[model samples]
Target: MPEAHIARTGPRILVFSTNPISDPGIDLVGSAHMRYQPGVVTIPVPCSSGIRPSWLLHAIEAGFDGVFIAADGGDCAFVPDCTTRTAKIVDTAQKLLTEHGHDPQRIKMAAICSVCAEPFVNHMEKFSAALEALEV
Candidate 1:
């Protein structure tokens, strides 16, 4: 792929997060001086459920090694079934990735509340490691 041929200093990650829930959690990570891969990039969305499966595919093709969706879960004020809807989105994206000859595990989804800074950091660490292992 064109993106693959581009040189990168480290694995790139794209994080899609909900504004009310996951965004705060991500901010907390910085406020608390938490350590995670600096290459992890975040984009705040109104809700994770609204993300199109093609967007995830585009990210991978654009050179992102992994994609992470930080869902609002039970804290979602927009939808009662936010988590379920988000999961379905991930599942669809995973299927598409597999059909395109990519590993589905590169995409992941998790409920991240306002206080989930630690969890977010941990997830980033694990995901970065997973991508590194894929290079082996």
Candidate 2:
């Protein structure tokens, strides 16, 4: 019997993560020996809420299939409403994507804690699948 081989066909993704929380969680993905797409790249930021919407759009225009924002949520040391502010940023980016004739769903935001390696991997897999479906 021969085993079937599966190839990864998803587009590359850009992740903007909060250094205090989501960054550690992303690191845990490696420490746990989890496997995500090799094309997944992460950029650590002081806070997800501080990311300008234009940056997200730029990522897409730069040929990334998707962008994910790992927000600090309520665990942000810098702000009380991290989730809300981050969500607003995502909303603005989504609109920008739409204005540029792209699908807004190409961008996503989620609350990822420092210990959330599994969740982060799950999100990556799901986002990759979604992007493949989009074929953009």
Q: Give all candidates' CA lDDT scores.
A: 0.91, 0.93
Report the lDDT tens digits of candidate 1 across residue range 35-110: 7877899999999889999999999988899999999999999999999999999999999999998899889999
State candidate 1's TM-score. Answer: 0.91
- Candidate 2, residues 58-94, lDDT tens digits: the string is 9999999999999998899999998999999999999
Model 2 local distance difference test score: 0.93
The best candidate in terms of TM-score: 2
Model 2: residue 56 alpha-carbon error in angstroms: 0.3
